[model samples]
Target: MPQPGATSRILVTGGAGFIGSHFVRSLFSGAYPGLAGSRVTVLDKLTYAGNPANLDPVRDQPGFAFVEGDITDAGLVDSLLADHDAVVHFAAESHVDRSITGAADFVVTNVVGTQTLLDAAHRREIGPFVHVSTDEVYGSIAEGSWPETDPLAPNSPYSASKASSDLIALAYHRTHGLDVRVTRCSNNYGPYQFPEKVIPLFITNLLDGGKVPLYGDGLNIRDWLHVDDHCQGIALVLEKGRAGEVYNIGGGTEITNKELTDRLLSACGATWDSVDYVEDRKGHDRRYSVDWRKINAELGYEPRHDFESGLAETVAWYRDNRAWWEPLKQRAGLA
Candidate 1:
């Protein structure tokens, strides 16, 4: 796999999602080394989470372009891969609760859609199809952090679908020698996140004098990575990551749901007086922590923001830009 040098033509799938959209901004803003003036074409399906506002910052940038489409569409994928040199795939069915209610869409969007992208990349001779995965694929961890070599034991339909896609990406690399890289990232919270997730849910509920719904005693633990840090890691992989390798992106912030919600309430200037404990969802993982030694040593990557600072910045952004997420909340039936 060739190192993605400065200004390489790249295709980013799902560039409209919370994480993917951040990745697109990083590209145009030149957040990573050797990426200035790089051309990025985002192929998105415009799912509920895909908002054009996410790409508002990059629409007119000289190196940025977007196409509203699904990755599973073989014809469109082939045509795009034929033009770009590298791919950063972030498109998938990501919400665990949605996946629990119905796994069918997750199966189609993650497994089949990734396969379509791989096939197109192979046919078009595209290099470095960076398949984005999730830490949930490794299941629950008690004390130790999960490494890239950890055996996958995904517990939720969302994680299972992502694991399935990661395997397909690796298979394409070994079987056909296509340059494919994989990244498994932990929980992400920042601006532009869909309100269905924990952060936005609690923030909006508090703002509206609604009860903060807590699931399953709120003990589920997850590492929270700022979207910008996640984007930086993805850019590093796209630019210098070794082929057929899996890098873990993490925030190094370990907190349980209960504790996290507490912080969120404080950020919103609310108290625990208005909380609702909801029935725990089935198969919720106990914890997730990424061992970033691989990407750290290889790419010299470390998260730029600490938890407190990042969370404060995140809270401030949401507070300042309620207009950006208010429509999403209403559309999702949260408002």
Candidate 2:
């Protein structure tokens, strides 16, 4: 696998979305020392979750470009890959509830789109393709944490599609010998996240004196990782991860949904009166935890943001950036 340097030309899919935009901004801002001067071309479909404003902070940085396009377009992907040395794939339909209601989009974007990108990368001889993935691919873990070696047992259509993409990505490395590295990360919460996601949704709702729905008993547990830390782990993987290997990135903080809701309520100056218990999501995982020791030992990856402080900061961001999210919520009919 070829290593990326300052002069490397990298393609980032879904760079207008929350996590992808953060990565692009970090790249241009020199957050990743190994990729300080790397050139970046972002190919995004500008889906509902993908807000162009997310990249506004670094839009004019030298060596940065953005192309509005879909990854499923084989010709487009191929043409773009020809100019890039590596790829960091983040495009996917990731909302579990939305996937349950309609799964075809998830399959097309997560599976077919991934296959299309991988094929293009292989043809273009692009090395070190980093596939960003989720820990939900392991399904519900009752106890302990899932290591990178765990068999994928995805429960939701969204996770299933992501799992399929993960396998397809690895298969390319195994059979065609593409330089593919996969990173499975825990739940992410931070600024610039679309309001449809849990953290932002709840924050925005509560800010408007609206009620938040707590599914089932709200006992479902999830490990939360700040977007910054998640991106840090990804940068480490892109810089030093071994090809064909999977790494789990965790924040080392586990909290039940009910507990999380309580914290959110407090953060937003709301009481339990603002909470409404709702039916649980179909096939909702009971808990999710990832063993991130592999990345820590291999790439010196460790989450820098504490959960309490991270959550508080996230709430503050949504509160302060209503101009950024209000229109998004109205456009998505989520308000």
Candidate 3:
């Protein structure tokens, strides 16, 4: 395993996106004790969801570099892997709504792009290639949470592609002896997030005095995870996780969509009047919950952020950072 130190050079794919950017910022800010002083190279394609301004905080930090490129490009991926000791992959076509409208992009980026990166890492003899994934790959659970060993039952194209990538990532470890670690996390929300996801979307909309959409009966349940906590778990997996293993990282806070909307409305000083009950997303999973005991037992990982405070902070961030998210919303036609 490659140890985290000053000499460590880590390649972070999708480092300009929401969750990935959080991880990159943490690495540079001494937030991850094990990875302190490690050099980081951010590889981002500057997609619609990726904003270069997201890395502005650490843009000029020592031992930090940014590359604008595609992960599916073998030449670029191969060249970047040559100089890096390890890779933390977060690149993907992640929005389920987008995937439902078009599946090709999801397959290309999530599945093929991952395979390309894995192949390059394998060729370069890289150690500890951490694959960041989602609990959605396990599909919906009616009651109990999903463990690391549970069978994958992804529902949407977005999740199916992620599930495919997860399997291929593990196959590299099993078949080629490449050191690979996988982490599946629940829903993430935090600052610098593009205003497309539910939390950010509703927050921005409510901030603008617009109506928020409540899909179906607003009864769908999801476990909310703060992006900081998610990144912490990924850092743990990157540092000490066993090769060929899957870890489930969760926030342990589960609530119905109706409940979440109520909270967002309260946070934004709005009421149920601003809500629009819409059709539920096609093939939407009723509830998602992950049993994160495995990661906790092995890595001493536990979420430190309180959901109430975290949600409040997230709302405050969007409310106060209109200059950051307004342009993004306008460009995406959400404004």
Each prediction's whole-model lDDT (CA): 0.89, 0.94, 0.94
lDDT of 2 by residue, 214-281 (tens): 99999999999999999999999999999999999999899999999999999999999999999999
Report the lDDT of model 2 for residue 177: 95
lDDT of 1: 0.89
Residue 297 lDDT in candidate 2: 97
For 1-335, candidate 1 gives per-residue lDDT tens digits of 44477747889999998999988887777677587767899999999989988999889998788999999999999999888888999999899999999999999999999999999989888897899999999999998999999999999998999999999999998999999989998999888899899888888778777888898889989899998888899888887898889999998999999999889889889988978899998898988998998999999889988888888887888788889888998998888
RMSD in order of candidates:
1.1, 0.7, 0.7
**Descending-TM-score candidate ranking:** 2, 3, 1
lDDT per residue, candidate 3, 291-317, as tens digits?
A: 999999999999999999999999999
Candidate 1 ranges beyond 4 A from true positions = none
Per-model TM-score, in order, reads: 0.98, 0.99, 0.99
Displacement of the residue 173 alpha carbon in candidate 3, Å: 0.7
lDDT, model 3: 0.94
Stretches off by above 4 angstroms in model 2 are none
TM-score of 2: 0.99
